[model samples]
Target: MPAPEGFAYVVRGADVVISHHGRPVTTLRGRRAAAFLDDVEREDPQELMARLTGNYRRGNERQARNHPRNRGR
Candidate 1:
């Protein structure tokens, strides 16, 4: 799948607020917030935010599509 887009983050005090397409999605606090800030600088920020917000691909679509229950579709 293509990389996600429209993800942005802002640090607020000890928290990190994540947004997608201008809408708030999730917040990271304390250690998680610290780690995210560090990683975002070195990795693809959009993908990272998508992951943090549980919006990234899980690589299971093909499997799901091939499952017996879904095969008829």
Candidate 2:
């Protein structure tokens, strides 16, 4: 399918993808996806850090509840 207006089509190996307003229109894979990620990295560092930190915090909370320190309380 053709990408919507204002969106750019990115071909990664054999797949086609699009991105807009700094977010990808859909999850893409392969070399093109990798390149897209690189572009995102170069464009936005704060948003990436926020996502990573949020994920880490969520996982840490799950792990903390299973730890011995909180096992009985």
Candidate 3:
């Protein structure tokens, strides 16, 4: 959401280094790295990297917020 920001990546030989807010988070290699590169050119890089690094939401926030326990907050 919010057009994920502060995500950057680097191509290192056969590996792809992904960083968030300037800190290294995960690295993709071989087939994964190649796929990432190809997708980056056609998709939203920030969202892609966020998902790969486990930093993106799982689409459950709205439900959680509406749960009975969270009502009238």
Q: Which candidate is the best by TM-score?
A: 1
Measured with C-alpha atoms, the lDDT of residue 65 in candidate 3 is 98
- Provide the lowest-lDDT 10-residue window in model 3: 1-10
TM-score of 1: 0.83
Q: Which structure is stronger by lDDT: 1 or 2?
A: 1
In model 2, residue pairs whose N, Cα or C atoms come closer than 3 Å (at least 3 residues apart or on different chains), thus clashing, are: 12-32
TM-scores for candidates 1 onward, in order: 0.83, 0.27, 0.79
Those runs of model 3 whose alpha carbons end farther than 4 Å from true positions after fitting are: 65-73
**Residue-wise C-alpha lDDT for candidate 2, range 1-73, written one tens digit per residue:** 2222344445666554554555565545677466656766585533443332232134467688899999997
Superposed on all Cα atoms, the candidates' RMSDs to the truth, in angstroms, are 1.7, 12.8, 2.7
Q: Report the lDDT of model 3 for residue 36.
A: 98
Clash pairs for candidate 1 = none
The residue pairs that clash in candidate 3, if any, are none
Compared to the true structure, candidate 3 yields what TM-score? Answer: 0.79
> For residues 1-73, could you state the per-residue lDDT of candidate 3 as single tens digits?
4777899999999999999989999999999999999999999999999989999888899999999999989
- Which residue runs does candidate 1 get wrong by more than 4 Å? 71-73
